[model samples]
Target: MARPTIYSDDIANTICEQIAEGRSLRSICLDEAMPAKSTVFAWLADSGRDDFRTKYVHAREAQADVLVDEMTDIADDGSNDWMEQKNS
Candidate 1:
């Protein structure tokens, strides 16, 4: 027997949107009662949604870059690490 079709593009798009909104994959899967995480990831990775994946990856990278810049600024100011002199 042939396997069932578990996902539609519309549904996949909705799930991807939720993920892009900062929702956790586990949470979306649980809420949607999806069969498996791999199923959702596969749907996202499909060729039809390549644009979505590219946009999502770029957004995440931008967020990471902002965080790194903030950390670097703090470290340069010596506020990220400080050592106190101890008397023996």
Candidate 2:
């Protein structure tokens, strides 16, 4: 099936949701269910899509926060610090 080009709240929300979930727009756009990256960019560029643009920006910020949290968790975890190489 062809990807959707028409702007809709559902599609906009889906894009933002994926972004918030730490998925890249490029990757999301690759999905058959989503529009092309250029189309998404166009949506962002459109002045009339202020709501979607806001949501998209917030989603990106949220994704960054999630990445930082994951990094912090990895740094705090000491379970792997005790691992030593075994002699063959």
Candidate 3:
């Protein structure tokens, strides 16, 4: 007999939460207890359940927001002459 898959609702939700917090799937898969990258991709590929798929997409968008925020902070640091030169 083959071993049953060990995925669970709690694990899925936790992954979604991490995604919402801006953690990439690659990083999530790096954790000791997290699912494998293939498993997570399988979840994203399954059309029957929109829950995980939707969460994953939204989480990617959240990561973009994080990137923009970081860029804004760096641009506003006021310690650089790059902006002055650009505006000149």
Per-residue CA lDDT of model 3 for 32-58, tens digit only, reads 688788887777787866877787777
Decreasing TM-score order of the candidates = 2, 3, 1
| Reference-based lDDT, residue 14, model 2 | 90
Which residue segments of model 3 deviate by more than 4 Å?
Answer: 1-5, 78-88
Instruction: Quantify all predictions' global Cα lDDT against the true fold.
Output: 0.62, 0.92, 0.76
After superposition, which runs of candidate 1 have C-alpha atoms over 4 Å from their true positions? 1-5, 32-35, 45-52, 55-88
Lowest summed lDDT across 10 adjacent residues in model 2 is found at 77-86
Choose 1 or 2, whichever is better by TM-score: 2
Which candidate has the top score in lDDT? 2
- TM-score: model 2 vs. ground truth: 0.83
Write the residue-wise lDDT of candidate 1 on 1-88 in tens digits.
3322376656656665665555666776665444367776675578886775776576456556666776778778965577899999
Question: TM-scores across all candidates?
Answer: 0.44, 0.83, 0.70
